[model samples]
Target: MARSDDAIAGSAERTRSVRLALASLSLSMLLPSLSTSIANVALPTLAQEFSASFQQVQWIVLAYLLAITTVIVSVGRLGDLIGRRRLLLAGLLLFTGASTLCGLAPTLWLLIGARAIQGLGAAIMMALTMAFVGETVPKEKTGSAMGLLGTMSAVGTALGPSLGGLFIAGPGWPAIFFVNLPVGLLTFVLAYRYLPADRKGAKTDRARFDNVGTLLLALTLAAYSLSMTLGRGSFGGLNVALLLAAVFGVGLFAFAEAKAASPLMQLAMFRNPALSAGFAMSTLVTTVVMATLVVGPFYLSGALALDAARVGLVMSVGPVVAALTGVPAGRMVDRFGAHGMTVAGLLAAAIGSAILPMVPAQLGIPGYVGPLALITAGYALFQAANNTSVMADIVPERRGLVSGMLNLSRNLGLITGASVMGAVFAFGSGASDITSAKPDAVVSGMQLTFAVAAALIVVALAIALVSRAVSRGVASTEPGAGA
Candidate 1:
C-alpha cells in the first residue's frame, strides 16, 4: 500500500512537470508568430516615426523573417548537438533581451538590426519547441502536444493585429515588443525548472557541428528568401538575379553536404517517401494559406465593400478558427491516426477552397467567412497530423533537425505564397496594381487565386496518396513480410 501510494505521488509529480514543460513550449511557439503579425501591423506607424519609406520600414519585418528562415535549420541542428533545453533557455533570454532593444532603439536602422537579432532568437525557439515534445510528453499524447503548440501558434497569430493595434493606440509602438518581457521570463523559468537536462554520452555528443554546411545552407536559404521577399509586389531584375543565385546556392549546399564530416541535414532522409511527402504537402498547404492572407484583404475591401475595420474583422476569422480547432484537430489525429487525419484534412481543405470561388457575392461577409473558416480548420488539422506523423516515430537525436526542416518548409511556403500567390491574384485580376484595382477585377483575381489554391491542395493530396501506398509496400516487404 505504501509502494502504491508512492507510485501515485510520482505519477502526479510527473504530470505537474509535463504541464510546466508544455506551458514553456507553448509560449515558445507563440512568441515568434505573434512577433511576425504584430510587427506587420505596426509598419505604417514605424514608417511615420522613422521618416522612412515603405521599403525601408518593411525591413523591420523582413529582417526578422529572413533571420528566422536562414538560421532555423542551423539552430535546430545546434540544439541536437549541444542540448535542446539549454539552447531553448538561451533563446528565451535572447528573445526577451532583443525585444527590449527593439523597444529602446532610437533609429530605424537600429530597430531593424535589433529585429534581426530577435529573429535569430525566435529561430531557436521555433526550431526547438517541437523538438522538445518527444522528451517532455508521453508517446500516446504526442498528438495533444502538437495540437497545443498549434493552438498557441494560431492564437499568437490571430491575437497579434488586435493586440498591436491596442498597444499602438495607447502606450505606442514600443509596447508591441515590450510585451514579450514577462512572457519570455516566465517561459524561461518554466523551461529551466521542468525540461529534462541534456543527456550525456549520446551518439550525437561526439558529432562535430558542420560549419561549412551550415554556412552554405544559410547563404542558399538567404538568397531564396530574398528572391521571394524583396520588391514585394514587383518581381524585378534583382529578384531574378537573387533567384538564380539561390539555385546555384542549392547546388553548392548539396555538394558541401555530400562532402561534410557531419552534415547539418542528412541527405539520405529525403529518400523516405513519407517524410518527403510531409515536407512537400506542408509547403503546398502553407502557400495556399498565405494566398488567403495576401489576397483576402483586397477582396474584402474592394469586392465586398467593407471598411478597414470590417475587413480586418473578416480576416480574423481564419486564424481564429485555426486556433479554436487546433486541440480538437489534434484529438482527431490521435483518434484517427496521423496518416488518415492528414488525408481527411487535405480533402476538407480542397473542398473548402473549391467551394470558395462559388460563394455568392450577395452573401457578403458570411459567404467569405464560412469557407475561410473551413479552410483554416482543415489547416489546423493537417498541421497537427502531419507534425505528429513526422515526429512521432523519429529517433531522439534527429528530432531537432527534423523539426527545423518542418519549420523551414512552412516558412518557405509562406514566402513563396506571398510572392507567387500575389502575382497570380494581380494577373488574374488583369490589374496593373492590385491595391487600386476595380471591385470586379478584385473579385476575379480572388476566384482565380482560390482556384489555383485548390489545384495545389489536389497536388498535395496526390502526394499523400502516393506516400501511403509506398509505406504499405515497404512494410509488406520487411522481414516476416505481410504475415
Candidate 2:
C-alpha cells in the first residue's frame, strides 16, 4: 500500500516537473518572437524621434533579423557541444541585458547594435527550445510539447503589436524593449530550476566545432539576407553582387563542410527524405505566409477601403487562429500520426490559398478573414506536426543541430516571403509604388500573389506525398516486410 502511494506521488512530481520545464521553454520561445514583431511597431516612432530616414530606421529590424539568421545554426551547434541548458541560460541573460541596452540607447545606430546582440540571444533561445523538448518531455508527448511551443510563438507574434502599441501609448517606444526584463528573468528562473543538467562525458563533448564551416555559413547567410532585404522594394547592382557572393559562399561552405572532420552540419542529412522534405516544405509554406503578411495590409486598406485600425484588427485573425489551433493540432498529431496530419494541413492550406484569391471584394473582411483563418489554422497544424515528425526521431546528440536547421529554414522562408513575395505582389499590382496603387490594382495583385502562394503550397504537398511514398517503399523493402 505504501509503495503504491509512493509511486503515485513520484508520478505526480514528474508530471509537475515536465509542466514547469515546458513553461520555461514556452517563455523562451515567446520572448524571441515577441522581440521580432514588437520592434517593427516601434520603427516609425524611432525614425521620427531620431530624425532618420526610412532606410536608416529599417536597420533596427534588419540588424536583429540578420544577426538571428547568421548565428542561429552556429549557436545550435554550440548548444549541442557545450549543453543546451547552459547555453539557454546564457541566452536568457543576454536577451534580458540587451533589452535594457535597447531601451537606454540614445542614438539610432546604438539601438541597432543592441538589437543585433538581442537577436543573437534570441537565436540561441529559438534554436534550443525545440531541441530541449526531447530532453525534457516524455517520448510520447513530443507532439504536445511542439504544439505548446508553437502556441507560445504565435501568441507572442500576435501579442506584439497590441502590446507594443499599449506601451508606446502609455509610456513610450522604449517601453516595448523594457517589457522583456520581467519575462526574461522569470523564464531564466524557471529554466534554471526545471531544466535537466547536461550529462558528463557525453559524445557531444568530444566532437570538434567546425570553425571554417561556421564562419563561411554565417557570411553566406548574412550576404543572402542583405541581398534580399537591402533594396527597399527595388533591386540594384549591389543586390546582384551580394546575391552572387552568397551563391559563391554556399558552394565554398559546402566544400568546407565536406572536408571538415567534424562538420557543423552533417551534409549527408540532406539525403534523409524526411528531413529534406520538412525543411523544404517549411520554407515554402512560410514563404506563402509572408505573402499574406506583406500583401494583406495593402489589400485591406486599398481594396476594401478599411482604416488602419480596421486593417490591423483584421490582420490579427491569422495569428489568433494559429494560437487556437496549435494545441488541438498537436493532439491530433499524437492521435493520427505526423505524416498524415502534415498532409492534411498542407491540403487545407492549399485549399485556403486557392479560396483566398476568389473571395469577392464586396464580401470584405469576413471573406478575407475566413480563408485567412483556415490558412493560419492549417499552418499551425503543419508546423506542429512537421516539427514533431523531424524532432521526434532525431538522436539526442544531434537534436540541437537539427532544431537549428529547422529554425533556419523557417527564418529563411520568412525573409524570402518578405522580399520575393512582396516583389511579386508589387509586380502583380503593376505599380511602381504599392502605397499609391489603385484599389483595382491592389485587388488584382492580391489575387495573383495568393494564386502564386497556392501553387507554392501545392509544390510542398507534392514533396510531402513523395517523401511519404518513399518512406513506405523503404519500409516494405526491409528484410522483415512481406509486402
Candidate 3:
C-alpha cells in the first residue's frame, strides 16, 4: 500500500512539473510576437540617436520580420530532424544574447544586423514551442493546450504597447530590451528544470539539409521585402534587380519543393480543403489585422490627438478582448465545428472594420471605444475559429510544420498588409511625399486608410463565405452553435 501511494505521488509530481513547463513555454512563445509591435513607438528615438532616416529605421523592424519570415519553415523542418527541445533552448539563448546586442548597438546598420539575429532566434522558438506542446500534452487535451497558447500570444500582443510605453517613459528605449532579460532567464531555468528531453523517439534517419532550397526561399522573401521598401521610390535599376530576384527565387523554391524528398514547406498538407481555406482566410484576416496594428496607433495618436500612453491603452483593447474571448470560442468551435464560427468571425470583423471610418472626429472616448471593442471581439473570434480549424485538420505528426506554415503565411500577410495600406495612405493622403505634413492631412489620410481596410475585411468576409460553400456548408446551423 505504501509503495502504491509513493507511485501515485510520483505521478502527481510529474503532472505538476509538466504544467509548469507548459506555462513557461507558452510565455516564451508569446513574448516575441508581443515585442514586434511594442517597439514601434521607440523607432523615432532610435532614429534620432543613430542619425538615421525614416527609411533606415524601417529596416530595424523589417529586418527582424524578414529574418523570421525567411527562416521559420526551414527551422521547423530542422527542429523535427533534431530535437525540438535543443533547438528551442538554443533559440532562447541566442535571443537573449541578441536582445543585449540590440540594446547596446551604436549604429542603425548594427541594430539591423542584431534584429536579424533576433529574428532567427524567434523563428526557432516559434517553430519548436508548438511541436513541444504537441509532444507533451495528452491527445484529448491538445485543443485546450493550443487554446491556452493562443491566449498567451493574444495577451502578450495586447500588453506589448502598454508595457513598451512604460519602459520608454521610464528609462528610455534600452529598457525595452532589458525587460526581456529577467523573463528570458526565468523561462530558460523553468523550461530546463521541468520539460522533458527530446533526444529519444525523435526522427533520426538519413536527412540532408536542402541548401539550394533554403537560399532560394531566403532570396525570394528578401527581394519581395526590398521591392516593397522601394515602392515609394522610382523604378530604377535596383528596383528591377529586386523584382527579378524575387521572381527567379520563387520559381526555384517551387521547383525545389516539388523535387526534394523532404521539402522545407510541406505543400502536400494543402490537399485538405478545410485546412487550406482556413489558412488562406487567416492570411487575409491578418492582412487587415496587421494594417490595424500599424495604422491604428498612428491614427489614434497622430489624428485623434492622443498621447503615446493613451494610444497604447486604446490599441490594447482589441487584443485583450481577443485573449479573453478565445476560450469560449474554442469550446464553441469544438462543439459546433469550423464553418459557422469562421464565417461569423469574418463578418463580425468586417462590421467592426467598417465602424472605424464612421467614428466621429468630434466624438469623445466612449464613441471610439465602442467600435474598438467590436473590432477586438470580432478579431478574437476569428483567430480562435481559424486556429481550431487549421490545427484540427491535421494530425499530431505534422503540427510543427503546420504551425510554422500558418505563421509564415500570417507574417507574409502582415507584411503585405502593412505595405499595401502604407501605399494607399501614401498616395491617397498626399502626405507621404511631404517631408512634414499638417495634422489635418494626416487625419484625412488615416480616415481613408481605415475605410480601405474596412473594405479589405469585407472582401475577406466574402472569401470566408465562399469557404463555407466549398467546405460542405456552414457548421454553425445546429442549435447553440457559433455562426
Candidate 4:
C-alpha cells in the first residue's frame, strides 16, 4: 500500500523543524505583494511633490514592473539550481534596504531607481517562494498552499491603495513606504528563525547565468516599457530605441536558450499545449484585470464625482471577491482540471467587462455591484486554475523556472494594462480628473476600455479551448485509449 501525500505533508508541517520554514515562505510571499501596493495611493502625491509630468509619475510604477519582469525567470532558475532558502533570504534583506531608500528618496528619478531595486528584490522573493512551496509541500497540498499564497498577495494589493491614502492624508507620501519598514523587519526575523535549509538530495546545478542573454532581455523590456510610458509624449528617439531593442532581444535570447546547457528557461516548456495556453492566458487575464484595477479608481473618482476614499471603497469590491473565490477555485481545479474552470471564468469576466461600459449613471450604486462582482469572481477562478494547471504540467525539478516565467507574464501584463488604460483615459476624457467629465464621454471611455478588456478575455478563452483540444489529442493516442 502506498502512503498518501497528505499524510506526508501533515507529518512535515507538524514537525517543529518545518514550522519556521513555513513562516519564512509566508513572509516572502506577503512582502512583495505588500510593497507593490503600498505605493499606489502615493503616486498622485509624488507627482505633485516632484513636479513631474503624468508620464514621469507613471515611471515610478513602471520601473518596479520592468525590474521585476527582467529578473524573475533568471532568479527562479537560480533558485532551482542553488537553493530557494538562501536566495529568498537575500531577496528579503535587499528588499528591506530598498524600502528604506524609497522612503527617503528626494526626487522622482531617485525614487524610480529605488523602486527598480525593490523590484529586483521582489522578483527574487517571488520566484523562490513559489519554488520553495513547490519543493517543500506534498503534491496533494500544493494547489491549496499556492491558492493561499495568491490570496495573501491579493489582500496586500487590496490594502495598498487605501492604506497609502491614509498615510498620505496623515503624514504625507513618505509614510506609505515607511509602513513597510516594521512589517519587513518582522518578516526578516521570522524567516531567519523558521525557514528550513534545503534538503541534501536536491542538486546544486552548476549552470552559469547567461549574462548576455539577460542584458538583451532587459534592454528589450526596457524599450517596451519606455514606449508604453512615452505614449503621445515627445520621445521619438526612445520609441525607436525600444523597437530595436525588442527585435534584437527576442532574437538573441532564442538563440542562447537553445544552446545553453542549463538554459535560464526551457522554451520547450511551451511545447506542452496546456502549459502554452496557460502562459498566454496568464498574460491576457492579468492585462485585463490589472487595467481595470488601474482605471476603475479614476472612473469612480474622476468621472463619477466621488473622492479618493470613495473610489478606494468602490474599487475594493473586486479584490475582496477575488480573495473569497480563490480557495473554492482551487478545490475545483483539483476535481475538474484547469481547462473548464479557466474557460468558464474567462467567459464570465468577458461578460462583466462588456457590462461595465454600459453601466448607466442613472442606475446608482446597486447597479455597479453586479458587473464588479462578476469580474471579481471570474478573475479569481481564472487566476487560481491557470496557476494550478501551469504548475501541474511542468516537471518538479524545473518548477521554479516555469513558475517565474508565468509570473513574469502576469507582471508584464500589469505594465501593458496600466499603460494602455492610461493612454485610453488620457485620450477620451481630456479632463485630467476622470469624474469631472461629461457623462457621455466618461461612459464612452469606460466603455471602450471595458470592451478592449473583454476582447482580451475572449482571446484567453480561445487559448484555453485550443489547449483542451491538444490535451485530448495526446490522451487519445496513449496505450490505454482502445482498452
Candidate 5:
C-alpha cells in the first residue's frame, strides 16, 4: 500500500515537471516568433522617424533574417555538442540583452546592428527548441508536444501586429522591444528552475566543432541572401558580383562539407525523400506567407487608408485562426499522417491567394481579412503536419541539426519573401512613397504579388503530392512492410 502511494506521488511529480518544462520552453519560443512579426507593423513608423528609404528600412528586418540564417546550423550543432539546455539559457540571455539594445538605439544603423545580434541569439534558441521538446516528451506524445509549441508560436506571431499597433499608438515602437524584458526575465527564471542539465559524457562531448564548415556555410548564406535582396531592388555590377559570390560560396561550402570529418549539415540527409520534400515545401509555404505579411500592412495603410491600429487588427485575424487550429491539425497529422494534411493545406492557401486579388475595392478591410484567415489556417495545418513529417525519419541524436535546418529554411523564406514581394510592390506600383501611393496602383501591385505567391504554392503542392506517392510506392515494395 505504501509503495503504491509512493508510485502515485512520483508519477504526479513527473507530470508536474513535464508541464513546467513545456511552459518554460513555450515562453522562450514565443519571444523570437513575436519579434519576427512585431517589427513589420512598426516598419513604417521607423522609416518616418529615421527619414529612410524603403530599401534602407527593409534592412531593419533583413539584418535579423540574415544573421539567423547564417549562424543557425553552426549554433544548432554547438547545442548538440555542449547541451541544448545550456545553449537555450545563453541564447535567452543574449536575446534579452539585444532587445534592450534595440529599444535604446538612437539611430537606424544602430538599430539594424542591434537587430542582427538579436537574430544570432534567436538562431540559437530556435535551433534548439524542437530538440529540447523531443528530449523532454515521450515519443508517442511528440506530435502533441510539437502541436502545443506550434500553437504558442502561432499566438505570438499573430499577436505581434496587434500588440505592435497598440504600443506604437501609445508608448511608441520602443515599447515593443521593452516589453520583452519582463517576459524574458520570467522565462529565464522558469527555465533555470525547470530544465534538466546535460548528461555527463554525452555522445557529442567528444565531437569536433566543424569550424571550416561553419564559416563556409555562413558565407554561403550571407552572399545568397544579400544577392537576392539586392538583385530584386537593383540590377547592376554590384548585384552581379554578389550573385557570383553566392554561387562560389555554395560550391566552396559543398566541397568543404564533402571533405570535413564533421559537416555542419550532412549532405546525405537530402537523400531522404520525405525530409527533403518537407524542407522544400516548408520554405515555399513560408515564402508566400511572409510575403503576404510584409505586403498586408502596406496594402491596408497605403491603399485602404486604414490606421495603424486597424491594420494591426486586420492582420491579427489570420494568426488567431492559425493558433486556434494548429493543435487540432497536429492531432490530425498524428492520426492520418502528414501527406494528406499538407496537400489540403496547400490547396486552401492557393485558393485564398487566388481569391485575394478579386476582393472588391469597395469592401475595404473585410474583403482582405477572410482571405488572410484562410491562408493562415492553411499555413497552420501545413506547418504542423510538415514539421512532424520532417522529424519523423530523423534519429534522436540528430534532432539538433535537423532543427537548425528547419529554422534555416524559414529564415531563407522570410528573406526571399520580404525582398521579392517588396520589389514587386515597388516596381508594379512605381511609387517612391509607399504611404502616399495611389490606391489603384497599390491594388494592382498587390494583385500581382498574390498571383505570384499562388503560383509558388501550387509548385510546392505538386512536389508534396509526388513525394507522397513515391513514399507509398517504396513502402509497398519492401518485404513484409505491413507486418
Candidate 6:
C-alpha cells in the first residue's frame, strides 16, 4: 500500500513538471512573438515623439529584426553546446533589461539601440523554445506541445496591435515596453524553478564552440538583411555595395563552416531533402503571409477608406482564426503526417491569395475578412505541420541549431516579403506616397501584390509536393525510417 501511494505521488509530480514546463515555454514563445508586432502600432507615435522621418522611424523595427537575424543561429548553436535552459533564462533576463531600457530611452538612437538588444534576447528565446518543448515533453506529446506554442504565437500576434493601442492610450507609448516587465519576470521565475536541468552527458561535454564560423554567419546574415532592406527601396551605390558584400559573406561563411572544427550550422544538413524543402517552404509561406500583412493596412485605409481602428479590427480575423485552428492542425499532423497537411494547407493559402485580388473594394470589411481568415488558417496548418516534420527529423543534439535555421527562414521571408511586396506596390500604384494615393491606384497596387504573394505560395506548394514525394521514396526504401 505504501509503494502504491509512492507511485501515485511520483506520477503526480511528473505531471506537475510537464505542466510547468509547458507554461514556461509558452510564455517564452509569447513574449518574442508579441514583441514582433506590438511596436508596429506605435511607430507613428514614436516618430512624433522623436521628431523623426518615416525612413528613420523604420529603424525602430528594422534594428530589432536585423539583430535577431544576425545572432539567432549562433545563439541556437550555443544552446546546443552549453544548455538550452541556461540560454533561455539568460535571454529572458536580457529581454527584460532591454525592455526597461527601451521604456526609459530619452533619444531615438537610444531607443533603437535598446530595441536591438531586445531583439538579441528575443532571438535566443525564439531559437530555443521549440527545442525546449521537444526536450521537455514525451515524444508522443511533442506535436500537441508544439501546437500549443503555435496557438500562443498566433494569439500574441493578434493581440499586439490591440494591446499596443490600449497601452498607448492609457499609460502612453512607453507603457507598451514597460508592460513586458511583469510578464517577463513571471516567466523567468517559472523557467528557473521548473525547467529541467541540463544533462551532464557526452554530447554536452564533447562539443566545441566555433567562434570563427559564428562570426562569418553573423556577418553574412547582417549584410544580406541590410542589402534586402535598403536595396528594395532604391538601387544606389551603397545598396549595390551592400548586396555584393552579402554575396561575398555567404560564400565566406560556407567556406569557413566547411573548415571549422565544430561548425555553427552543419552544411551537410542541407543534404536532407526534407529539411531543406521544409526550410524553403517555411520562408516562402512567411513571405506570403507577411507581405499581405505589410500591405493590408495600406489597402484598407487607402482603398477602402477605413480608419485605423476599423482596419486593425478587420485585419485581426486572420490571426484569431489561426489561433483557433492551430491545436487541431497539430493533432492532425501527429495522426496523418506532415506531408499531406502541408500540401493541403499551402493549396488553401494559394487559393486564398488568388482570391484576395478579386475581393471588391466596395464590399469592404466583409469581403476582405473571409479571404484573410482563409489565408491565416492555411498558414496555421502549414506552420504546425512543417515545424513538426522538420524538428522530428533532426537529431536531438542538433534541435537547437535546426530551430534557429527555421526561425532564420521565417525572418528572411518577412524581410524579403516586405521589401519585394512594398516595391511591387510602389511600382503598381505609381505613387510616391501610398497614403495619399487615389483609391483606384491603391487597389491596383494591392492586386499586383496579392498576385505576387499567390505566385510565391504556389512555388512553395510545388516544393512541398516534391519533398513529400522524396520523403515517401526514402521511407519505402528504408522500412525502418523514422518520422
Per-candidate TM-scores read 0.98, 0.98, 0.85, 0.87, 0.89, 0.94
Report the C-alpha lDDT of model 4 over 165-236, residue by residue, as the tens digit: 778889888877777778778777876766667657665655465666666666777777676556543347
Q: Candidate 3: where are CA atoms >4 Å away?
A: 1-11, 169-172, 199-206, 230-244, 301-303, 307-309, 393-397, 427-451, 462-483
The candidate, 4 or 5, that scores higher on TM-score is 5
Residue-by-residue lDDT tens digits, candidate 6, 1-483: 999999999999999988998899899888987887899889999999999987898898889999999999888888887888888899999999999999999999999999999999999999999988777888777677778888999889998999998998899999989988999999999999888887676235435888888888888888878878874466578867877998999899899889888778779989788899989999999988887787898998998889977888888887899889988888887788777888888988999999989988888887888888889889988998889888986776788899999989999998888877888988888898787999999999989988988999999998988877887788778956663
- Write one digit per residue (lDDT tens) for candidate 2, span 73-168: 999998888888889999999999999999999999999999999999999999999999998988778888899899999999999999999999
Q: Where does candidate 2 have its weakest 10-residue lDDT segment?
A: 198-207
TM-score of candidate 2 versus the correct structure, residues matched by position: 0.98
Ranking, TM-score, top scorer first: 1, 2, 6, 5, 4, 3
**Clash pairs for candidate 4:** 20-194, 21-194, 21-195, 302-434, 302-435, 303-434, 303-435, 304-435
CA lDDT scores, all candidates in order: 0.93, 0.93, 0.74, 0.76, 0.84, 0.87
Query: Candidate 1 residues 271-361, lDDT tens each?
Result: 8888899999999999999999999999999899999999999899998999999999988888889999999999989999999999878
**Minimal lDDT window, size 10, model 3:** 470-479
Worst 10-residue lDDT window, candidate 1: 199-208
lDDT of 5: 0.84
- lDDT at position 273, candidate 1: 86
With a 3 Å backbone cut-off (N, CA, C), the pairs that clash in candidate 5 are none
Which residue pairs of candidate 1 clash? none
Q: List the residue pairs that clash in candidate 3.
A: none
Give me the displacement of residue 36 in model 5, in angstroms.
3.2
The per-prediction CA RMSD against the true structure, in angstroms, equals 1.2, 1.3, 4.7, 3.9, 3.0, 2.4
